[model samples]
Target: MKALRVLLLLSLVAGSGAAAEPAADTGREPFVFQSDRIDFDRERNLVAATGDVELAREGRILRADRIVLDRNTGIARADGNVTLIEPDGEVLFADSVELTDDLRDGFVEQFKARLGTGSRLAASSGQLQGGTRAELNQAVYSACEPCADDPSKAPVWQVKARRVTHDRVEQQVTYRDAVLEMWGVPVLYSPYLSHPDPDVTRKSGFLTPTVGHRSDLGVRIETPWFWNIGPDQDATFIPIVASQRGFIGAGEYRQLFDRGRLELSGSLATLDKKPKERARSGPRGHLRLKGESHAGDDWRLRGEFYRASDDGYLDLVGLDSSETLPSFAEAEGFFDRAYARVGVFDVQELRSGVSGDTSPLAGPELLYEWQDAPSPDGAGRRPAAGAALHRRREDENQRVTLEGGWRLERFTDGGHRLEVGAGLRGDFAHGDGAADDNNTRLLPQASAGWSYLLAGGMEDLQMTIEPRAQVVLGRNSADADEFPMEDNRAVEFEFDNLFALNRFPGLDGAETGQRIDYGVQTSLHGAGDWHVDAGIGQSQRRKANRDAPEDSGLDTAVSDIVGRVGLTAGEMTALGYRFRLDKDDLTARQTALDLSVNLDPLYFDARYARAVGVPDPQKPPGPAQDKEEREQVDVGLGSKLDANWSVLSRYRRDLDTGRSLLGGLGLKYEDECLLFEAAFEREYKVAGGDPDNRVSVRLVFRDLGSLPGTQGVLPGGRR
Candidate 1:
């Protein structure tokens, strides 16, 4: 035998004249062959190659131990260790195969293939058509990796079909009489099934269904359909059928553009009507629209609108749990040293006994702020102006404000720091209804502060301590009572806002009179990634402001002491605490604690909070008219039992009332090809009504639209 490697150009022509033309002119690639030994038979127009034969044409390659090609029939046959590589990176293996001259169409025995998505397919026999379609008999498909220790062992999950077809052009796989198996045991059978090819990211199809039981809604199943409307647009429709509640439908539509995106989501349902109802049935629904766009390089426009048919509709449908729905639109701009915004907003109250008409609608609010470049010595100044118009059924008001400020800081070589600042603000307001008056006021404010740092320790351990204090002085507004309070009704004095020049959150109110805020903070760093930090502070005023609310913690000449403490050890444990103590008795007025620990496969987290309301000094000292204390705690823990299994549990309780507010437990298993989840949740009080219990189960098969909770009622009966 002689080793022969030949490049043969074989073309099929319709006539003798066409055969005279070159293969390039026909727009088709000719076959090229290589072999250790080659033979040709002129009478039959056949070529036989043996021992490591290889053929290549148009980006497709075929290799075998022996191959025979017939020029008269444009067919090739190969036996023993046959392998074919397609243009799209798919590899097929068979014991024996027959294919067209171009290798675009083929038939294989004992076929096995490796797809682009790392999945595997095997069949007793396979037929390839037009290079884009494959039909198989007695096929098995799986995305799970086979056992490494024992090659013959079954995968975690697989699908077996009597017949299966894959169409590359349509990017889909269709199966007939398919049986889904787990660990080689058949669990489900379907007459017909289809899914998008692994290469497809999005397509039109019915997504996985959600099955659950709720006390109020009973047993429910939700099946959703997704539509790939276009390259940049899509929509999903979720229709739910409940054993006791009939039907409910929800949908979401989204579109994308070069600079922005828009989304719309809504749901509607009809239920039994009470006496004197205007319509045939009581209808409930909700709509939400959100959009954002870049108007230019420095400006953005954004808007969101939310509306519900009734106060309890969103809660009952597990859509939203907020007590108030708000709608707003705004345009914002950013510049080198300035910022501006224009916006409007409206709110609808959902709390029982609260009239929606009392909620104010604010529109045409304008704001502009600019800051000057800092001076060489670390000094800067900012000037701002704003205007707002507010209206409600009971009252109407308009306010305009102008403000300017400046500050400077200096540091000494000895670790001593100094800061100083001054500013002026003016407010003009016109009110009607509740406050029928016009008011104008000017406030001048100034502040100064100083601090020192001391640090020293070994390389493995370090410690630092810092003491700071600030004094602020401002002229009090004389006629503040003549104007209505719009945005400054609630005030909280905490460590975060202790040293601010103005403690009030809004311009409608201001902290006045001379005051001094002082505090000291310390930290320690040790080996093994250990660290600790603590800080404490207090505020002292020359005279108490009579207009301050009783529970503000700042109504007295000496305000509450606020502090925080934190500790951490590597990545395994962390603890943080914050508290406010009454000045007179040193009693805790408010406190919060948070702890988290991660220990190998197990993790835990907890949060606790408590607040004591201050008694109104002017309330004649009788029984309190409202609850004055609040306490709550939340705990969560989870464990990853193994690489593919996990459990999670959570509980929330009202410590003051010793009542469990909510509790939940969940178990999940996930692997390369499948995900399974089950959860149970209990709510002690829902919408101020009776308790509710729910259970949910979900299954997700890899490479399918089986998201866990994107469309249905999530854990705890919330979406």
Candidate 2:
């Protein structure tokens, strides 16, 4: 039963406008009261409400079985299932409560609160002071979700504190004499602990700690502290302690500005003593520094510097496994159709019998590139130009190289293509007790090719078959043996590079004789989300370069046959294979295969690669190229057993030696408010090296602050 009722009582009170209005009245606001049954005692200046009583003002609501309000004293007493909801959507429930005039200061017994972070707080007794502070005695807090199947079951994790204080204005919570409980068992305790409210974006605090064991470092632990300098800047400091090694410290700092951001991180340590000779030798500790920055919208900078106190320092400390660290700094910029970059690079040797003087260094490297838009004349021709300067140490001599080139390509309507390119490069050699001299060479190249697409296959299938041929000519017939090989050493023969003027990746080494490159390719596109592509190619050198790598597939008149095949089935599976076979015997010289599949709860991937060994033809052979074949296989799997549990595993093995290289297994569990994971792994360092074992564990509690309450219809209360 409901009725429309309105009461407007206007009375001039002492030093105020209207008596029936709120205390801080703006004269425009009104004070309304409603209940199932309302009765006023004029003699006592008191109002009593029963039967689902409710009082709402300024977005704040108070509901209880019964409530009594004294107009003169401005105090409200609520009994029987009392609930108070704040304007910010927070809710509190208590058996009984007494609130002051402004509803700011109050006391509650057998109370519980639900915060916005999904965490809950329950206390035997609580006090609200000044509307911005709350004090709870003998309280329990938990972020874990209770079992919906059984309301009587306890949460997975919780924290009990003798006393807790929450400061709404500062957005922080502090606990004293706190105990951390897992699965209803107390596992950790602290005298004092504090954290910013979940609503806080950044605050100073201690992050989770990590503990692990390594063969060289033994048992080790790392604790990190985070500091928020400002809204755009922050830093973290981590201190590491190990039983076998001394203390080490690592830190990282980052800042954001209007134009760009900067980040710098590093780690340093001091050794206890020299390790035994039988152990991995080299540095006693490691040093690593890295930084990156961006300026404006078109410019960027990056740098990396890493070094080890000894050969085993990095691997033992679990920082990195490489024995050689290359340090470099580069800056790059982009324009409308042009790009420019400059950098300096050097290498650090941490291995035994390696000297710094023997390692090469590039003091300064510069490059620029530009491209012209397609010709408006409809020839579909594009012109591109590039230039570079490199100063580095090569073969105990100081070498300097300056080079530039331009290429023009024209495409015809009949699928015909023509390319013309020319370049002039010079090299100046000096220092290292070598005769100062300059070697200049001019390179001119041209190629032509034609292709046709033959469509209309079986059942809406389309097929394309294309055969292409190209010929490249150079001015110098010296095979580039006179110029020091600074950058281009390893060359891979593939269909993509079949018609290339130079198979080498860089300008250091150039192909110097006439050559004919040709290939045939076919592709099939089916209607049922299936496709197949395959190609076979080879190169023939009219004049051979005896100085080239023997198995590089480019030194003989008839190079090895390079072929590739790829197949895909929409989004479910894919497979690809590439191989280089000997021209005479058709024996595989280099081969690789990759396969992947994704089907709901099951996923898998596998890769295998084998590179045959062949002795270096140019250098006096110490270790034959095929002395130890490079063959390995890698595979991984992931399966979701149910809604909250998943299993994952990965493995890598040396197929030739039948030895396990690396393997790991992991299990993970996650629910609404909690996540847990554990993993075990084994890693084999290098040839003849023993295996290293490792284990890791992690846990996360989501929605760290929340509370429970009954259903309500207030403007901002739970729906």
Candidate 3:
């Protein structure tokens, strides 16, 4: 055997005398051939290579045990373990192959291909043409990896077809007489089927259809069509048919721009039978639109619009579960040391007895804040201002506010920290309609605080305790009673705002009179990644605030005590609790608890909340009065039975009434090539009427889209 390497150049024009020219001079890549043994017959224009033969041209490479080529005909034949590699990372293997010298057009026996997208295809024979198309007979396609322990074992899922065609230019695959198999067992058969190749990012097509059963809606099926309008925009239209109800139409459209994007989605339906409470049948629908854009280098604008045909329409169609719909538009600016914003908003009430007209419309609200750079001594000044207008059916109100503040901090060598601050604010307000009034007032406020940290611990255990105190003195607005509380309708006293110069959340309200807030926060860390943190605080005012409501928890001289506790053990377990206790009786007014645990195959989580309402001081207790006491609990549990199977369950109940609100159970199975899920849910309470039950199922094929019941078939669709 002779190891010979030859570079062959063949010109398209016969007898052009370019065979001896260099590959670059001829303007075409020459075929570089290698073999341990080679023979050539110049008269017949034939070349033969044997024993580890290899040929390379352009980016394509072919190798085999033996090869024969005809220069005049530009043909090549390879036998014994033939392999061809394409430029785009595709590898083809066959027992024997015959192709043009360029390798674009070929015929292979016992063909197998590994695609760039991690998919596999195999056929008894295949024909490659035009460098972009392949036709196969008796083919099988799958995305699953072969079993490592048992190489001959069947995949989890695969598609077998009598004839298969792949079009690289179009990025699509079409199959005839296709049969879907699971574990080598035929489960479904189709005369014709087609899908986009894995390389296709977007294409117009009909997505998977969803099927489900609901107690209120009966049996329903939804089929959606997606339109790939352009590179920057797309849309999906959904049409649903129900056995017991009317036909429903829904759609979503989205577009992207250089500086912004917009989206709109909605649904509409006309019932076949009108409800007994309505006089006539009418169409019900819901609409939502959202958009955002960059206005400048440091500014952005955003807006949202939402509407519904009726209160019960959303609930009946399972569109949304919100109790209110809100619409708003706003612009925000960000600077090095300043911030500004302007916005307008409105809300629509969806509750049964609530009137939308009662919801206030607020617009043309402006807020601005700026702060100076801190000096070497940690001292700075901040100025803030705001204005707003609110309108309702009964009245309209306008307000303007301005404030200035300064602060400084110092840390002592003895582990003591001190802080001081002061500010002055002015407020102007006017009201019309039911309450016609005008008022102006100037408010001055000041605050000081101190804290110290104490630490002690061993190598395995450490502890730290910090005790903090602050005193705030502020003068109330002289005409506080002349204006209504628009943004400060609900006031909560908690540890989060215990030490602030002004505890009120809105400009319409302010904390008045001198008060002292004190709290102690402590933490402990032990071996095995265990830790605990706790804090407790209370406020004491010099005198009761007449402007504060009785149930606000801050109207009395001694405010309610607020505190929280948290514990964690590594990444497996966590617990947190927050509570507000009445000052006089030390009874809990509000409490919230959360706990979660994760132990390998098992996981659990639970949440509980309770709040006690206070009676109106001006009204006597009676059976007709509304009770505000509320308590609820939610719990979830899950377990992984094995590598491919899992079960989950959830329950939510009203503790006060001992009634279940919602409960659900789910099961899932997933592997390398397939996923299947089924769920059952029972809703014990709904806005419109009686209890409801729903069952849904979903299946997904790897590298392919989902078979939908609740989940969407496209990328980023509903899940």
Candidate 4:
């Protein structure tokens, strides 16, 4: 309504170059007025402007054919072609309006307005009440552009109500007997509807609802209510009713403090009877909590807690799509070039054949690390160090381990690059159910590397070829097999770790004896913003490490050849490939490829990974047999058919088993006044059941609330 004052003032003073002096005794700012003819009614104490008159006050203006003002009564009337201009450049139109001198109390006929948010409002008649509220007899509103050809035609969508009230004091709009119309046809009706105006960002109300169908949960419907408790805190509660699972309640609470933020979300449901009549399956649910804050100058604190009533609860009720639930809490601190962290974690093993009793809970793990960045002077050296203490609790056994390590390295370049590095690590272990209850091992290692780069290519196509070699010396620990391997389970042989000081990933496993790691890498920077890089490396060990799985490519005297290739052309395309080949037969042991192409309307992304299982060392060695194998592929496609329509598809498949893991297809349409989406998806082996088929649809009207019915698609949490 403030716009009304500005618009009216603009129309009243458009041609008045300067404001007229105020009355001698009024003690008020002067009013600017312009007109073809102005008459002063001395006897009646009235001023009248006729024929293309304009009036302005402050920064507002109003133009009308005739304007009449009664100085004594403090009433103003504007008739014929009335237009008001606001300071923010908003213009309002009305057939005629009457208001007091304060520009608060007013009445408008045939009023049409365009708000700053691109929304449109029209009223048959309106009454200004209490200087802060406006009531309209009959009104219609939309956030759509009217058709230039036929303004009378209905917009894509609109809301029509018998009585509409705008309460400026509350920043809210309320409607009575409201009807939601699409193409002029009423599709939904409600006795009352209210929402925060465009200016209000948060308000308490009923949010959109979700409707879906599942094999286990049957027909699912969830309606969520939002409570805006305060400027920094809010909560949403959703009550779900399913034909198969009965009623379930879920909610999320979030709050932002001066220095941190916290959030919690979860769901609970009660079943009439458990499927397969499992013991203790009456009620199921899951909860997750997360919080982060600054502790001090260089330290930060964070914590997380997640738990599930049962392994199948999430999958059965569609809360979490994963079969595993991991819960943990941690705290961390940071310093210049150094950091420390402590954490405790527990995993709920819901999968069959897995016993939670045997799974150890990480009671408390303390770790510290410090590393210096590469020398900025190009001639300096630095040392890095780390330490850790881990305690785990199994069924009847408790284990404690302490470990520490340090690495020092120096690098220099003079025609050929040279690097010298040394590392030392020690481990102390004391535990109950192990071959060696108490044990200690010390490892010392040293390595030297040299690399030469040959750069010579055409002016437009520059290329570089580099060959590097490193020889590492270490003594094998005879008691390595007597210790328990708790943290580390698998080793990855990739180009990124090809030249690492140690081939094993964790402290529990370390390589020993003499070894030579050599590789040559080449790079090409050609025309058209294109670049290509490739590298291959292999390791030759003086002694075989039978402790490593055969498929790990590190169990033999000669390690498998590992290589990687990367290609990119600006933002439009990217491709990467990494693989390990058998040292003797050159057979692929593990391979992965990732690629993405963004070519305008045509976009594609894909990833494929395959690995041959390693041979089990516990079994006798005769003919090497694969102990495990995995192959999977993921692909996505997106296309914009036109300005208002788009299509998307995604697929995940297990190539080894020739099975489709997950697939989805979606279509979207959007225009000036309407947005529509429809999606269908299938999730296989999720929640430990058959493939779950789901279909969801959504329609949102610009100004009015959206037609709330869709599956609760958790943002960023894909099954």
Order the candidates by TM-score, highest first — what do you get? 1, 3, 4, 2
lDDT of each: 0.81, 0.69, 0.79, 0.72
lDDT-wise, the better of 1 and 3 is: 1
Q: What root-mean-square deviation over C-alphas does model 3 reach?
A: 4.1
lDDT by residue (489-572, candidate 2, tens digit) is 677777777777667766567666677778899999998899999999998877676645667788788888999999999998
Residue 588 shift from truth in candidate 2, angstroms:
1.9
**Residue range 447-501, candidate 4, lDDT tens digits:** 8888888998997999999999999988864255765665555678888898887
- Candidate 2 overall lDDT versus native: 0.69
Clashes of each: 0, 15, 0, 19
Clash count for candidate 1 is 0
lDDT of 4: 0.72
The residue pairs that clash in candidate 1, if any, are: none
Displacement of the residue 191 alpha carbon in candidate 3, Å: 2.1
lDDT of 1 by residue, 266-331 (tens): 999875443453333466888999999998899999999999888767765556778888899999
